[model samples]
Target: MLLYCFTSARTGEVHESTARRASAREKTAKESDEDLEARVMAACYKVYKEDVPLFFFNIFTFFLPLASADYAFRDYSSAHKILDAAEAYNIDPLENNILEVIHFEDSIRDVPLFRPLSELQVTKSTGRSRGADVFRKEFASLGHRSGYTRNVTIRSCRRWALMQVDKNYSKTARMKFASYVSRDTHSKHYAHPLSEVEGLANYLGIESRNDHIQNRRGMGMHHNP
Candidate 1:
């Protein structure tokens, strides 16, 4: 994604290796904080004007982890807001739901920028506890936004999956596929079985080898590999 950003910023004329080397060279020259900030803001503004949907999706993905955590904690209000926004735009939110490909350019003709982040409160205390408290509050707000995006994605995926099975499968097959997709999305994406289900298993004294195996896989471990 970083490479994509870099290439886009440069208009894709430069080769990847050339771009990397150029970036490395530029890094050697110490940049003042103000200069760096100016460059970053300029690049962001350019992207915002040139490709608004990419900007929106980038922001959505940035908060996605926090959104997933919020959903896992049982919050649904944020997710509802995101779904409402997508519905208003008639967006499906699938991975391949590009505006050009899906012919949604007309739908988002007047789309607005995302809401600004909440202002951070000024704190007088320099103590660790005060810092931690502020950090926790800021993180909670971010998590709320993130949960919204995750829910939107999950709902979109669910709808798309259902449509896919309906068009291509027999009645019985459609039913089976719908049931499996729902359970999979609920367990893997929203509920997160490793955290929620494993804890439940521990409480019920039903923890098993399968749970351990899943935990390992979730951590990016693979027995075959």
Candidate 2:
């Protein structure tokens, strides 16, 4: 017997090109009920989950489902039954579930803009520690949001990660963020798009608001990436 090997350039893995086909053929000859069933289930998922016409099943599932079908195409009703049984899940429910646990504060103050670093009294304010903890927790939680779903989280994580620990280190963002914290004349200050997540008092879900001075009209998420 000649063994055929094919190397896939994308993944850089050597594949035993004939192994599956040969095993499937051997299985066809012996016809073990359990092995055939597993193959049948796999084929069923591929066909149902993907939008493909029945005639095109051969091209899609590597002809594996067709082989496992055991006259599945011939028996049209049985094929329909298999296809209809495939499972799919909606992520809206997952997002809703996440929203349920998240809390938001409507009256939260943004950091003061351009406040001299000398003015901050982190030791006197309990809110400062609490807010920082929320940002940190938001960064630590969740499997990543695909795009901008966690835009707030993304910005918070970025700022927190990029910040220098040394007190005197002057990053452009630090004072602007301080201004945001003070919530003083936030109307006059311009914030980076990523820092926009800090507007909420404390929250995970998104909120819609209109600030005529800075954004005039806009929507933003309330938390970290």
Candidate 3:
């Protein structure tokens, strides 16, 4: 209506007197609808379920009280429903993206659904500090991380940590490696393996060939996340 008024005025098709009357009536018509307007205001509540955030919805709906008295009815019930739904189901979406240290805790508690800590093959380190021993003591009786001797060609443990954190392997590759290592480590799946350990070593410039190196490396070998 504003545009029509402007266009009409510019073209001189409507007299100023006529434009004034039309604008007044248009403004009155806009303000006159109470029920239809209120329903429209109520309908805005649907934004809660859409991409909009709950806080935004709350602020927008707060002005519902400022609407014409008839249009001021608030939808607190709908708002509460939306807030409840978000709280109930809103897992930190980023949790799925990153492997967190806490995930190991969950994996431990859930058992069988996720890989146990013992499944990740870690090379034995030197010394009797027992870092590897501690890592193994609390889990399934699988892979051995013992003191290394001259004959054992143990890989770097850091590489294993890197693979745990950053590497992405094909499902087929993972299953095949898991099967092969499990046979040696005595498990069905291998969580930490040669590639992972190798990757970590390369990144950290730590050569963990035996428990001597691993002992020096200590808990630093496992990826933090």
Candidate 4:
């Protein structure tokens, strides 16, 4: 049931139908543009379920404004909804984008949403500083900030911070960050066995396996001599 609600909200099929009906009514009436718009907005609200997913709510709140200048100019309600939804969901991207639009649009900045930006900024800064302090403690515990371990620790901390800020952050990016950090630290500090090297070389389509053995012997001889 929740999935169905999410799908309906995400696709805006229901809203589209409501809009079409509103248009039909508009054609029959001599209503002004503002009245027609208000009626449509009211119709859209009537279909909203109480348990609408935060994701859909967040998208619905600000997407219209970003997508259409005319909507942004006339839709203070959407702007207000975005402010409430963003705060409720702790969605930084939504908050940031809407704040940016309000900042530059000038025409709508005086609305109630604009007044909250300063408070939001302070709250975000405080949260970031708290995260930084926690990171510092964790990083300090790793000790000796100039080594491979330090680099890995830093990357891990950064990944954690990204997760905190955005729940929808890419899983592939997280995997890549982890994979690269692990591979780098292992390659730099741990020597692979000869069999492992030969297997890896074979996998990579490098020349005959004997080359690596011969190179190792050559390096050993050079060091000894």
Number of the predicted model whose lDDT against the real structure is largest: 4
Return the lDDT, model 3, position 119.
32
Query: Which predicted model would earn the best TM-score?
Result: 1
Q: Tell me the whole-model lDDT of each prediction, alpha carbons only.
A: 0.35, 0.30, 0.29, 0.35
Taking all chains together, the TM-score of candidate 1 against the true structure is 0.20
lDDT of 1 by residue, 85-132 (tens): 457877556764554311222222222111113311112211111122
lDDT, residue 204, candidate 4: 83
Model 2 over residues 136-224: C-alpha lDDT tens digits? 34444542443345434333333332232112334445445332334332224333333323455336556634244235213344333
Model 3 weakest 10-residue run by lDDT:
7-16
Per-candidate TM equals 0.20, 0.14, 0.15, 0.17
Candidate ranking (lDDT, best to worst):
4, 1, 2, 3
Lowest lDDT block of 10, candidate 2: 1-10
- Candidate 2 residues lying further than 4 Å off, grouped into runs, are 1-131, 137-143, 149-184, 190-225
lDDT score, residue 165, model 4?
A: 27
lDDT of 3 by residue, 84-166 (tens): 55567657544234221111121122111111234322122111121222322332222223332221111233234323333
Clashes of 3: 14
| TM-score: model 3 vs. ground truth | 0.15
Better of 2 and 3 by lDDT: 2
